[model samples]
Each structure stands twice: as C-alpha cells, then as structure tokens.
Target: MSSILYEQSLSFKRPLDFVFTYLADHSHMSDWAPSVTSASKTTPGPVRVGTHFDIQMRFGLSDLSLDYHVTALEHPQYIELKGKGETFSIVERLRLEGEGDHCHLLYQIEVYYQEPVSKLVRFFSPIVKSSIKKDLVYLQKALDQQPSSWKPTLWSKMGDRLLLPGMLHFSKKGFASAKDRWIGVTEDLTGRNIVITGPTSGIGAAVARQLAKLNANLIFVCRNEKKALIFADALEVEGYPRPRIEIADISSVLEVEALAARLLEKGEPIHALINNAGALFNQRGVSAEGLELSFATLLLGPFILTERLYPLLKKAGEARVINVSSGGMYMQAIALDDMEFEKEDYNGDKAYARAKRGLVDMTELWAERWKEDGIVVHAMHPGWADTAGVSAAMPKFYDWTKTWLRSPEQGADTVTWLAASKEARETSGLFWLDRTPHTTSMIPGTRSAPRHQSLLRERLEEYSQKLSAVASQSFR
Candidate 1:
C-alpha cells in the first residue's frame, strides 16, 4: 500500500508573524489538537531545525507514541517536522502566507503506515480529513488568545500540591486565591433563568448565592423544600430576588422527570442547568427506579433531567450545562457492568466514585453531540470541600483533612466560573478543576476506551428515553 496523504488549510484572523510565533511553540499543541493527549520537548534549548520533541496522541482505543524532530525551518513562512513511531511515520508541513491582517495556513500531513495498517488508514481518510479541519478550528481559537495565556507558571505546574499536602483529600479555598484565580471575571447573567440542583447547602448553596449576586433568576431544585425555602428567605432578606423553588428527590428518576415536565410547562428558556446534587452514602440503597442511590443521584437523575430539558436549553440559543462531579472519580474506572453495584458487594465510596465517573464521561459525549445546537456541557470536581455532606458522610477523614478542605465558596468558584464565563464557552466536553481543564483519566486502566464510552452514551440515552416514555404514560 502507498503512503496516505491528508492535507487541510485554514485562514486565521491573525497576522502571519503572530500565527507563526504561537504555532512554533509546540507546548501549546495539546490545547489545540484533540488527538494529542500530551507533548513535551525531549531535547533542551530553543526550538530550531533538528530540535526533538515527543507527543502521545490518541489512536482509536490506544495511544500512538511518536518522536518528532524539526527537519526544516524557514522563519515566518514555512516549517516542517518529521515524526517516527512504531506503526507509522509522519511528515507535517505548515506554510504560512500573509494576506493583509490575516494569515492563510497551508497544513499538510503525510503518513507512511507500516504494512498492514496502510489499508486501515486508507479506509478512514475521509474521517481523518474532517478531524484535521476540526482541530484547525481549535487551533485558530487558541491562537486568537493572548500569547501569555499559553505559557504555564512555575506554581501552576505544581497544581496546589505545595500549598496543601497529599494527605489532604479536598481542594482548599485560599489555595488558588494567590493566583487571583477569579480575577477579570465579570459575567453578568442578569435576568437569565438558571436552574441548580441541591442548592440547600455546600457547593450548591454557594453557587446560588454567587449567581444571585449576578442578578440571575435562580430556580432551586432540591429534595428538602424547607431547607430550600429557608435559603430563599435568607436571600430575600439580603435584598436578593426571591428565587423560584421546586421540590423533588433528585435520586428518583420519576421525580426528576416530573420536575422537568413542570419546567417545560413554564416555557421559559433555561440559560444553564447545574447538576450539583450528589451524595456519598454509607449504605447501599436503590432509587424508585431500582437504580443504585449514588448512581441515581450522581449520574442517572442528572442524565435524565438534562436529556428531558434539551428543548428548553436549545431555546436559550447559547445555554450551558454544568455537572458537579467529584475529584474522587479519579480513583475508579467506569464500572459499566456494575454501574448499579448489583453484581458485587456494594462499597459506597466506590459506588459514588463510579457514578461521578459516569457523569463526567457522559458530559464529554453530550458536549460533542450538543455543540451544533449551541449547547455546552462540562463536568467539574469541587476538589475537597468542607461541607456538611463530607462531615456527615466521612467524619474521621473529614476530621483529619478538614484543615485543608475548601470552604463551600471556594468549592463553588469553578462551578460559578463555568456557569458564567465567556472564555469557558469556547471549549466543551472537558473535565475541569480550579478554573483549568484537566485530563479525565490520570491512571492508565481507569480511562474508558472510546468504544466503551460511546456504548455508555448510547445506553444512557436509551434508558433516559425508556424511562421518559414510562413517566409520560403514568402522567396520562
């Protein structure tokens, strides 16, 4: 089989020099290229012809590790790199041409697949070309940002580890403060209809207050009406608008469906939906739908609610969905077989972690699918927070890690940022923490394969539709 060649070109709304400068800095490759999971300069000193770097990219179910060496450099006009790997060799060329203020980028990719793989490459050429053009859009957007934003500081590289010890289980409120984490944040969601679950306490309560300050019309969904009403009263006393309240046990799919129905009936466009209601139960329990409690609350309920509310979200033109997941999800794999914990002995922590994992996974799929509809879905973990839920659920660990735990306000910072920030709207389907996007999986075995991830999304949609039909029939 002959070598496969895939090429694409794009015109960026930036100067030729500016585009060249940004693209020359290979460190920013991961930010723009979705397939490039990670990259690093293996060779030291400034980048020039013959300088070497390594990149780990996604190739279907596996990673394609490649070493790239700069072969040619023609200053602001042209540059080329040659990559060698186990299964393939690649030659990438970028030729920049200036046209007034903008630059036309002629990018070409030549792949020499080793033997048996060339046939497969030929078959997927169309999809490959499409993905290349899609990645170019991300590249264009990233280049539009200030060059300074592309560089990471020394402290950011540590990511809160120095300020807090590894023994700490949660994120600290004051930790990211030194960086002025929320500086330049001025999102006024005034008059926007924002729905938030579990607004009675902890992160949810914190987010509600923040959004209220922004004059958003908040609609609180919670199992406890009294707590929600009390919170609303406090808001009202503080001169904030009285927020609309809806009572429902979020752990129950039927209740979530009914709640969605009421919201739909109102016909108001929902600007954003934040799925912040979650719990780590010490004992195993099933929801009204026979789903495990943690699975029901953390994953299933939010999934169904988001699925049902699609019409309202679309109606908002550019609405966002934020799923409040937990950093604890890093510890576990997506237990597809034991999603409900039916087969194995139920461990509440594992169940909670698995459910959060499922939620994050679904967020990725939803973001990809809903982008065309102008809807963005994102999942973020609150890190470690000093919340009543934590105190009650895991007391001993809480007692030890309490000193390092984030205040509810600290925990809600990223959630509020995601809900309100314009910069965040640029990217979707990413797992976020501390206002920065992080990889969904750190440990090798924990990451869900692409095929399995797709399967899970399908299964979730099927279940949501099935339950929705049942709920509709019962309502009749």
Candidate 2:
C-alpha cells in the first residue's frame, strides 16, 4: 500500500529552544496538537528513543487511541515518533531551527494502512491532510498564546548559549573595571524621582531591584498590594533599600493621578518614569476605561501617566523616561483610525503590536519635546525574558521558542543599563536592544511622515494632549 505523506513548515515568533522543548515533551502533545485529545506515557519518563505513549485522538465523530513510540531523538534539532493502532500506523517528525527572535518549525507525517484498508486510504488521504493542517493551525495559535515565561526542556541551557558571546565581548572590552564600565559614576540626579510601573514582577521587578541596589529612591507602582509588599520585603532582605510602594492600576489615569498626588505630597522631584507594565491578552477584552485592554494597558495608560507626571520630570535635572516596548511591534503596522478596535474585529496580537508601535512613536516625540528640559526619553524592548508574562500568556509560542529566549536577568540587563548606566545617560530619543542603541522596525512612508525621528515631537505633543484630556475627564 502507498503511504500517505505530509510536510509543513511554519515561522513562529518564539525562539528555537522553545520549540524543541515544547515538542520534546510527549505530555504536552495535547496542548498544541489539535487531533490529540490526551497523551499519556506508556513508559516512565524521559522521552528517549523507544519510549512509548498512548494518545487519544478525535476525528469527526470517530474517537481513536494509538500507541506511540519515540523513533528518533536528536537534541535541539529533531524528534520523530510512530503511532501504531489496530489497522493504521503513523510516523511524525518535528524539525526545529532558530532564527533571530524567531523559530522555524517543520512538521512531517506519513501514514500506512492495513492491506484491505489501503484501498480506502487513498480517499481518506485528503481528510487526513486536512485534519493535520487544522491541527498545525491550532498549534500555531496555541503557541502564539504562550507566554515568554513558559519553560521548555530545551531552554534550560539557553542562557549559557545566549550570554557567552556577549559576556566574552564585554569582558574583552574590560567591562569588569569600574572606571571602564561606567558603573561607579554618580551623576547628579538632584531633581529625579523615578516612578516605576509594574515594579512587582519580571523585567520591571528586576529593574526596580537593581535601582534599589544602586540606592535610587523609587516609587514602585503596581496593582497587587501583597505582591508589592513581598517585593519590597525581598529588597530589604537583599540589603537593598526598600522602594516606597504605590498601589495603582496603570491602566487607569485616575489611579495614576492619585498615585502622582501622593508622590507630590512627598515633595520629591520626578526624574525618570519607566512605563514598563504591559499585558498580552489572548482574547479580546476591554478595560475599565472602555478602551481596548492591550491598547489601554500599553499605550494610553502610559501616555496619560507621562503627561500627568511631565511637570515633575521637567523639574528634574537630566531626567530620563524609559518606555518598555516589544519586538512584536514589527509584526504589524499601526491601525490609527481603528486604534481602539471599536468598529473592527479584534486580535490580541495585532492589538499588542499596534500599542507598542504607538509607544515607539510616542517615545521619539517625547524625547524631542523634552530635550530642552534635559529629559532624555527612549524606548526599549527587553529581550525575550523567561518571565511569567511569557509563559502564561503564550504557552505554545513559549514552548516552541524557549530555546532562544533569554532569562529575566539577561533580558532586564539592557533595561537596567538604560535606566542608570552612564553610557546611556547622554543618549536620548533612541531605541535599545541588548544594551545597544538600534533603529526601529518602522518602514518609511506610512500614515506618519517618512522620517520617523523628525515628526516625533509633533506627534507626541498631539497624543499627549489627547491622552491628558482623557485623563482629565476620567479623573473628574
């Protein structure tokens, strides 16, 4: 009987390590593979070659269970499995490749039927192909939903691989020396009081911790009061000065104003405001302010907060405002007219991308306007960090790309450097990746002007006024 053959290749936004790890776990088959309703190990653990499992699959009204065994295991490269059942046998292979900030996955399958059933297999080939294709699409969607923090077995050593070259380069450049690395310099932050949003977890938490260690008095703003307390306590335990906890929902302009008022009462000059809290919703949702949740969380909220805090930032000497954006901004262009998705279909990923692009534009605008105040503003994409935000939000993507994802410590390294390092002190109105300045992914000649930097000031001022108006109404 002729065997049915299938092959498919897909580009995933996650890292190569993440792909390998997620596919390597037999237990997770049901998580991404749509046809597989459940997968259980027939052998103990460790899916080495020859390890077997039982997988239940549902195709149309027919429910089937197949005994599967790992036929091939090559670390960080490929996995092949074969499933045997009463009258059918199936072979599946998953191949993975790492691309910069993305992963490529190739899935191939073959099926053989019993001699008598072989005659019917030809007619069923299309059905089989359609089912598998549907499965792959579902898998891709599943991965896109995975968070940056999802741990795949293959990513355990990713940090060692990712940092080796960078660390070696830095070491060769004499980064260890205090004088050479600009770690010891204490430039006057006389007017600067930093407001760090989402200071409780992931890159924000790490940045806050590092700032506290540097003896920077910070107002740590977050929604979770208990988590904030825990974080403050952790800092105290680590011998870092405890930053004052300011409870507020950054998505709400009113909360931001209230928090700002409390800080103003303390009479501290605001120097830097790190708008770092962000969300990636897999499904469509709206915030309390009636704005699309991702838009509100990432762009609108930060915009309003910055406007409310602009006076304080201007009062500071050489103040800096760092906006945390994402590389996902490259995925899509700005939907200016339908920014709020009020009249259009909503997609979480596109919503996030739009918000981030807006953020980048806003960063450039603010940097240009605030230049006179010595307030250097910049936006940064914290490298793919292994944080809960990634794991929980994008499990399938995390699983597939975990291999190339950086640890939270490694990801936050650039953010911390931008926030405090003297190397970045003089540099403003730029985007940073891996602690080095880089240009944005914006293409020339969109709805906005061709030269992104040139038009930033005007755009930012316009957006700032709009956001401020929103805040004023919301607060009242």
Candidate 3:
C-alpha cells in the first residue's frame, strides 16, 4: 500500500528562536497537538537527534501509545521525528524559515500501514488530515503567545507536593504573572464607548480604569448612584473624561430593561458591553422578578441587557460582550432543572458557581449566535484576585492565602486584554485566562451536556421576553 502524506504551512509572528524552543520542548507538544494526552522526552541529555519521546494519544476510541525518535535536528531550521506502532508507522518533519522577527513553518506528515491496516488507515486519511489542520491552528496560536506563569517551575512543583491543594487550584495568579506579553493592554480606544457594570470597586473598577486611560468613553451601569458619582469624580481627577453613570439595580429585570432602554435612546454606538456586576450572597435571596439573586444577577441580568442591546452592538460593526465569571465555576455545571436551587438546600458557594457557569455557557452560545452579526462575546475568571469582594465574601479563605492572591489589575489583565486587543477578536466563544483560552471544565461532572446549550438559550430568551413585556405594560 502507498504511504499517505499530508502537508501544511503556517507563519508565526514571533521570533524563530521562540518558535523553535517552544516546539522542540516535547512537553509543549501536547499543548498544541490534538488528542496528545502527554509527550515526554525519554532521553537523558539535551534535545538532539536520537532523542526519544513516549507519546500517548487518543485516536477515535483507541488509546495509541507509541515511541518516537528524533531523526534530525537543525536548530531554527528543520526537525524530523519518526515513530512506529504495531500496525502503523509515522514520520513528521518541520521546516523553519526565519525572517526578521517572524518565522515561517512548513509541516509535513507521512503515515504507512501494513496490508489490512492500510485500508483502514486510508479510509480515515481525510479525518486525520482535518484533525492535523485544526491542531495546526492551535499550534500557531500557541507559538504566538508569550510564555505564561503556568509553565512548571521547581517552586510550583514543590508547592504542589507540599502546599495546601485548594490554595492553588483556583488561583491562576499563583501561576500567571500580572502582565501578559502577547496581548497589549495599552492599545488606543479613542472614539470607542465601553459600558461596564459594577465599576465602583474590585475587578470591574480595575477594568474601567484601564480602559479609561486608553481614551474609551466610559459608561458605568451601577446600582449605587453615590458610589458611581464618586468613582466618576475620581476618574475625572485622574484626567479621564467624566464617565457616564446609569444607576440601575441589575438584579431587577425592570431596572435592567430601563437601563438598556435609556442607552438605546441615546443612539450612541456601544463598542463593548461588559456584564461585570455580580456577587455571591451569603444566603439565598430573590430578585424583583422573584428569581434567585445569584442566578438573576450573574446570568439572567446580563442576558437581558445583552439581548436588549443587540442592535446597538451590531451598529458598532465590531462590538464585544465580556462576562466576568469566577474561577469558582469549576465546581459546578448548569443544573437546568434545579437552576434556581428551589428543590435542594442552597450552598452559597455552589449557587454562585452555578450562576457563573450558566453565564459562561451563555457566553459561548451568544458568540455563535451573534458572530454573523459582528459581535464577539467571551467569558473569563479573575482567579483569586485580592479584592474587597473576596475579603467580604470569603474572609477566612482570603486571610489564609492573601499573599498568593493577584492584585485587582493582575486579575483583570485578561479582561482588559480581551476588551482592547484585535487579536482577541480573531476568535470568539472561548473561556480565557491570562491572555489565553482555558478549558471551561476542569472536573468531570462540571461540564454542561451538549443538549444544555439550546435549553439554556431558550430559557434566557424566554426570560428576556417576559421582562420586556413587563417593561412595556409599565410604560403603557
């Protein structure tokens, strides 16, 4: 049987040294390569020709375990790797060209199989090629990013063994630096209008401050008129334009509707709508609409506002919607049936997490629904940021790990990055942390089922319609 070959060429805007170093490290392969659960260097010395890698990958439903040997290594130029399994053999090569600060990469793969396996392999060739193409997109993105603090260090490894587990589990700041190299935070936002909720304090305030410095017209949708005015005065003192403050309790569907209507009446383009006003109540409470407070504030409120402002977002031509969720969402999935937590006892933390998870689910859902309408929607977690909200809500936990926490600006870096960067607009419907896409679910039971997408979307639409109808009757 004839050997199958596939080829792809892509360019990385990063330095050749950066590209080569990142790819040459076997451990980084799994970060970009599809279905690669792990890649380890079995050799004792530095990476060079003859170095061996034990790779474990999942193909369809089968676990593929294989050993690959480096056949050739020419720094900043070429690399070739060969692997053999019981039924098949493989070879992959990379050709690199460096130009100024950019690198061009040419990747090629060849696969050969024994008699009966050949038929099966060829039959799957299209799928194999498609998978590689998809993986290459991820690889290119990986190459373009600056190294994050998530890189394993001796201290972190030791901490993993010795330190308290829960302390670092949700703390991205424990691993990620306050600054990001890939996404620039100082981009100009002149002539842009950015609407942010809960800008009086915490991560939302930090995000507002950063965007203001970039010359964006700031609109604060806040509950406390006094605090909103005070914060607006502070921004003006800092030489920022007087921020527009719209006082509305976001948890109230009527207020959310009123806020959106007021903004719509202004006829000004909305460059971005940041749904950042959210809180975890120590006890379960009800909104004006009689929905659970966490659910209403975190998910339903944002949904209604975004839905009402859909036309305005499209008017801006390339608007963005950013949902500020919490890393605490890792523990919960969308419990659609018990979404309001009416059936069981409500744990404050779990209630808060479920609300954030629901919002995250909607972020992805909205991005897909609105992509053709020119709106980019995304969701992100602050990752144990040292903020007043944390101190008040989880005082004991904050007191214990205060030193490990990131500053408000550090935690808001990804949010600011996503808000201002053109690169971030390239892809939508992703959960982000430290300027890169992160997995939405880290635990097995924490992911929403495939069917939950439409169900949640429909539910939010129903809520939006109900709220709009109420607002209409009140007006009449």
Candidate 4:
C-alpha cells in the first residue's frame, strides 16, 4: 500500500476524558469497528505512552492481526500509534480538544503495503474509508447509551476467586474493569510531599508520574543520578514538575540510613513514603552491609527508611506509608531462621518472595504501632506486573506470562490509590490488590505462624541497631 492518507474529524458533546478513554481502550474494538474481529491490549495498563495492542481485522477472504505500538501520548489531548502486520504497516494519530460539554477529535491514519500486498493496495482505499465511516456511526450510538453504573460488577469478582481466571484480573483487562469504579483522584496535591524509592522505572516510575500529574511535591530516592535525571526531564517536558532526587542504593543498609538522615535533616513533612525499590537476584549475593541482596532491598532497607522517617510522617499528620509487596509472596512465608538463605540452595525468586512476605507482616505491625501516631501503613501486591526486573530475573516466567502481565501503570494503580484516595484514608493495616483489601496469604503454607510477625520485627530491629552503630562509627 502506497501513501493514501486518510483523515477524519468529529465533534462530540462528551468530555475529553470520556471520549478519549473510550476510544483508547481496545478491549471493545469489535463492538464499533466493523472490520475488527477482535482486539486486545498486548501490553499491561490503559492506553497511554508505550502501551501496545493487537488488533485482528477480517477483510473479505483474509484476516490479519496488526500489532500496534503507541509512540506518543499526551493524556486526553493527543496520541500517535503505529501498527505493523505481516504484510503491511499503519500509522494512526488521534488528537482531542475543547472541554466540558463539547469535545473535538481529529483522527488521521495512513497505510503501507509490503511485497505481495503492494499489488492489492489499489482496492483497499475504499474499504478503509467505508470501515471508518461505519465505525463512527456505531461508536456514537454506543456512546449515547453509555452506562454510568460502571461500579464493581460481579462477574469480574468471580474471576478474582478462581485460580486460572484470577490471573486474567492481573492483565490489562483487569485494570480496565477496575477503572469502571474509579471516580478518579479529586485531591489537589500541590503542597503534598511524597517520597518514592526506585522512581526510575517500573511501578515506582508510574506512581511518581501520577503524583506529578496531581501536582505533588516529589522526592525520588534513586541509585543512579543519570537515570533519575532523564526520567525527571521527561516528566518536565510533559508539563509536570521535575522531581527532586535523593541518591541512595536502597539495597544497602548503610546507604538507606544515610538517605534517611539526609531526608530527616531537611525536615520536610512527608505526606506519603512509598517503599518500592526491589529486585530479584538470580544468584545469591550479599551487600556491603553483609545482608542478602534480596533481603536488604525488599525488607530491611524499607524498614530502616520508614523507621527513621517516623517523626516526619507524624509531622505531616495522617501520613501514609505504602509498601509495594508482590503476588509472588503468596508462595513463601518468612524464613525467619534463614533469612539470608545460607543453609540451603539460593533460589532468587523464593528469597525475594520471603522478603516480600516479611515486608507485608511488618506493614500490619507498623499500622498498629503507629496508629496513634496518625501514620497509616499498608502493603499491596502489584499482581504479576511485567517490568524489567521480571524480565531480567525470571526470563522463563516473563516469556510465559508477558502478554498477560500487568503494565507498570496497572501495577502502580493501587499504590497511587493508597497514597491519594479518601477511601484508603479510612483504612489501615490491610494488604490490597486492585483497590480492595485482600487476604495476606492465599496459600495455607504461606501463612505466618503466631510468632512470625514478632520475629520479623525483632530481626529488623536488630538490623536497625547494627545500621545505626555502623553509621555512628563511620561518622567518628
């Protein structure tokens, strides 16, 4: 297919977020687009920058799936995406404008054919126009009858209980369904200071982006200044305030303590502290602090950081501490006796899961201990998110579940909700997934014993003392 640029413009009486969200979501593509037989988000998350989709369209005697990648996006304002197939490629640009009761949409698309498909390009132009025109009619009709009762439906909840089907809720479809009940965060966070560890990528980056969008004062705890600067620059270019960076390797207890000291020295009243830095090491390794890498990063680092920041959290009044745990923790309980995995073979995933389990237990303990301090502590599982950590640490699992894994944004959703939502403000000490409180343990074997949380607290306290003593000696 040569260059036949197709352009279309439409006006609607709906708000931009409404129209844009509807069009951007690919799950219901077959409902309005005649040629599209099926469509699904191939990537995790809602349609936004970096999201991908697979669209299958039937044309007379042939059908093909076009894999689309979103190249650029500016919220509800503008979007550009490209789709490639076995025989051809396509470019699509969607722009939205106006506000309140009226909105304007400009849709542009172009198609290119390769090799054998080049000869059949002549007959495809008319088909493209007809498809778009028909799509507009059905789309408007569908929008006119759009249901407002998008509040929690029962079928999806049933999916949450079943094992195989429950995995579906970990994908983009689950995020889309969860969006049904979203009224969206109404709070203006202009003066709210939120601290996020590991804000350079994955769920931490996503959560940071959301907070920036809400105008919160952001403080990022990053190990690499270069990556943090690049990420902050991108945020600034996108019209968000550049996040203030605090350098620290959260995987090392010494660095974490120093990071906490610097933050406390500033005396900023932190509205929310998100302990999101973590990694799954494929092989067992120990930090300079002598703690196992996974143990230090996932549990001890966050524990020390949160403990040192207690006064600032109380100063903010009604502060929040959101610990980003993982669904993998459901498989492992806290190996209190062998936290470093020194007695047996070191399987990285199991070590990571155990640390996460301990982190969850500590969350409940902190919530109760700090309840009078006006600091709410909560733990949440991101639910099989596809991130760089997953790809690097568990390639086999990533390859098997990549298509269905939750995007960084989807994984970060509950974290942002816990940080900003009024409903979340009413609760404490719960393990959450998709905005609802969930059981701390799914498997019976993973359940903590009566003394487990106590031991976890005691051990972390011991580590805290060691960190403080080491820091004091270094200062001397």
lDDT of each: 0.78, 0.69, 0.79, 0.80
The candidate with the higher TM-score, 2 or 3, is: 3
- Ranked candidates (TM-score, high to low): 4, 1, 3, 2
Best by TM-score: 4
Maximum-lDDT candidate: 4
CA displacement after TM-score superposition, residue 143 of candidate 1 (Å): 25
Q: Candidate 2: where are CA atoms >4 Å away?
A: 1-192, 442-476
RMSD of every prediction: 18.3, 17.8, 16.1, 7.7
User: Ten consecutive residues with minimal summed lDDT in candidate 1?
Assistant: 177-186
lDDT of 1 by residue, 1-476 (tens): 54767777788677787577556646446445766654656665456888787877765657688899889888799989999999789899999999667888888988787778776876877776676666665676555542213123454445533434322324452334322323323344777899999998999998897787556899999898889888999878655678999998888878998999999999999999999998899899988878779988988899889988999999999999999998778779997766788898889889998889899988988998899999999998888888999999999979988877876766786788788777778889988776777667755688888788888877777778887788788889
Better by TM-score, candidate 4 or 1: 4
Candidate 1 regions off by >4 Å? 1-170
Estimated TM-score per prediction? 0.66, 0.58, 0.65, 0.71
lDDT by residue (163-250, candidate 2, tens digit) is: 4433322221111111111222122232246789998888888777556644677788899999999888877765456678889887
Give candidate 3 misplaced runs (Cα > 4 Å): 1-180
Error of 4 at 91 (Å): 17
Model 4 off-target regions past 4 Å?
A: 1-161
Best-to-worst lDDT order = 4, 3, 1, 2
Write down the TM-score for model 1.
0.66
Candidate number with the higher TM-score (1 or 3): 1
lDDT of 3 by residue, 201-229 (tens): 99999888778756789999999999999
